[model samples]
Target: MKFTTKWMAAYFPEYKGAADTEIPIHHIYTDTRQKTDRGLFVPLEGETFDGHSFLKSAINNGAVAAFWNKEKPIPEFVPTDFPLFLVDDTLIALQQLAHTFRTEINPKVIGVTGSNGKTTTKDFIASVLSQNYKTHKTKGNFNNHIGLPLTILSMDQTTEVLVLEMGMNHFGEIERLSFISEPDVAVITNIGESHIENLGSREGIAQAKTEILAGLKSNGKVIIDGDEPLLAPLHTREGVLSCGFDEKNKFVLSDCKMDDTGTRFTINQNINYMIQVPGNHNVKNASFAIIIGELLNMNQEHIQEGLSSIELTGMRLERITGKYGTTILNDAYNASPTSMKASIDVVKELPNFSRKILVLGDIFELGALSEMLHRSIADAISEPIDMVIAIGEEAPYIVEEMKKKELAIEAHSFKTKEEAVDILESTLSEETVILLKASRLMEFETLLEHLVEKE
Candidate 1:
């Protein structure tokens, strides 16, 4: 059980009915459609919908208590004895409750933020830390203001480590999440171009990402990318450990190797590590986990075990066997110029693929730099890459740039994913490997529905 109604009453005293009852609340839910066990329903208001209207559905789905907006009238249907905590803003009340619950459980919080690999890094950290601790991590894309609180509130009382992936599109967002999480360990994966349109430049992005430090506990540990020039200022800070391929980092990575299976690398020229995912970028992400494991005094054996058995979120460099034995690298969860290029490089390095095709799509939030940034992806495409099938509005720039190179590779452009599905299906074969990448708006995973081999 998470907490009792009596326990929650201590935090929210302005409530009516059953305030003294010891009814257990095992879950906290927002969506009325999701069934819960003794849940506390939080009615959230959005642009097009108000969850307040569905309190009856929440009640039918096992919501024992709920937070009602003070502006809304107590519905005539609501039982007079049912617990209803009145609040001016249900969202803020939810956040405050989560903060109190987090303090009560008192897990060692780890806040991870970066342009690209925050989710993957959160997975790595949680996997490694769970080897020696009762760990809980942010689920799916639940890293925003609402999602982070829900993630915290969802954790069991026994959790010893709380791993949160923090995401943002503008400034001050990470600061708000950091303050809510109050992490003991803050990790800045790397400074990339993920939200350059809103943040302005790589430096601005770094500033926004580093807002995770705003709520860091005194004497807390900080992990960062030593290779990123924007984060170089923190290289010498007390209790800060930098991890990267650069020799100057506190935890240096080298001797990296990748193949069809995964990546192998060594840290500080002594400890060797292997992860089931292939890419130098992944190596850096794994290094952040290794540093955290060491800081927590985990044995090298457990760290290795964690990395070897790591399971990533879907649509992230996932390898699938397609029709006619074709290989599909679905990195289509989301994309930016930096990540798209990184995905392209991973495909370029893999061996034994006679036909390597790139099914590229537009990257969003690029603002005025969309054309130039899309064109820059072609810089990573060269020899051994047999075909480039570009789709979406700005993705055609990638093909246009490749055509300027006049290489022997086949390059095609289509305005939409539907237009390219037939060509992608025909190109699949035993020797061919295809990489699919795009922004979340592109819904590139739908393309997989047509390409994945069905039983």
Candidate 2:
């Protein structure tokens, strides 16, 4: 049964039931567009537009209930029959409701946070945990403040394990999400060069990621990346499980091989395992899951089997055939210099490629280190790439670095994505290995979509 108003009000004392004490909402929705019969719509504020304007349409589309800001005039379109979950702020109300749901649902929560691989790690853990239990995970990039709440509230009563990816950009964001989640187990994938603009340094980012522990279960297990020097100190917590390539890790990954298809590796105490993903980082992420599986007394084979199952989110270093028969490593999800370089390495290692091409856009949030970090990507382009297409303001520095190093590879800079795509379309060869690496704001996926369609 969907969450009734009764259980929601139990923990949310703020919840005042309908006139007779029955405020039944069949479903919850953040997007007004999806509002349907018995839908509780929470109108969010965005930078470009206010969702309040859409409330009328939401009800027209069958929204039976809505969370409206007291400031806005109630739209005439919504019939008097519908109830408005009135609040000072709709977002906070949604978060509070989700917080209440967690107390009621009591799922075995596994929260993951880090600078780089949280989503991948979350997916890996969910796959492994799903083998023996009903598992739910944050889908796509829904790991932010509002998204996390929605993800939590959506879990059913039967949800055995809920894998939540808790991502944060600034100080205390992870803390907020963690308090809402209060995970039974917390995983830190690694502290990488992501969101360095706002946080200032990799160390600062590490501190932000570690805030996941603030709301962790008192006896919860903390799984960390032992290979990351920045994260190594975090294992001081008792019952912490360290997983990485290092021998000292509780779950050590060795004999790793990465191909265009996937990576193969073996855990120290477990049989050989392979994951259908390209990167040592991914193997590390999967290793965390293997350790957790062992802790929960799950079938070891199922853990490996679970790792082998499940498709990852798109635009995350995905390998796909594109136009002109190009093999594209579409890594446009979001990027840092670290991830960009990793994708380059993955593409460079792929066999039988006639020409290696790196289509790199700007890495956002490097702060003062943006130029140096962008230029540093040139160092990663060793022998494999025939040409480097650098886009955005940082492209010039990347090209200059490539030239100073006396690399014979061709370097092209474009401020506009149109010119970049035109060059990619006309110059791309049949056997070229094209790697698309960029930040989410750069819209690199548009080029990827075009390239894929042309193929």
Q: Which candidate is the best by lDDT?
A: 1
Tens digit of per-residue lDDT, candidate 1, span 259-290? 77689999999999999898999999999999
For all candidates in order, the CA lDDT equals 0.92, 0.81
**Candidate 1 runs further than 4 Å off:** none
| Model 1: ten consecutive residues of lowest lDDT | 446-455
lDDT of 1: 0.92
Residues 377-410, candidate 2: write the lDDT tens digits. 8889878778899888875688889999999999
Candidate 1: deviation at residue 437, Å? Answer: 0.7
Q: What is the lDDT of residue 244 in candidate 2?
A: 83
- Measured by TM-score, the strongest candidate is 1
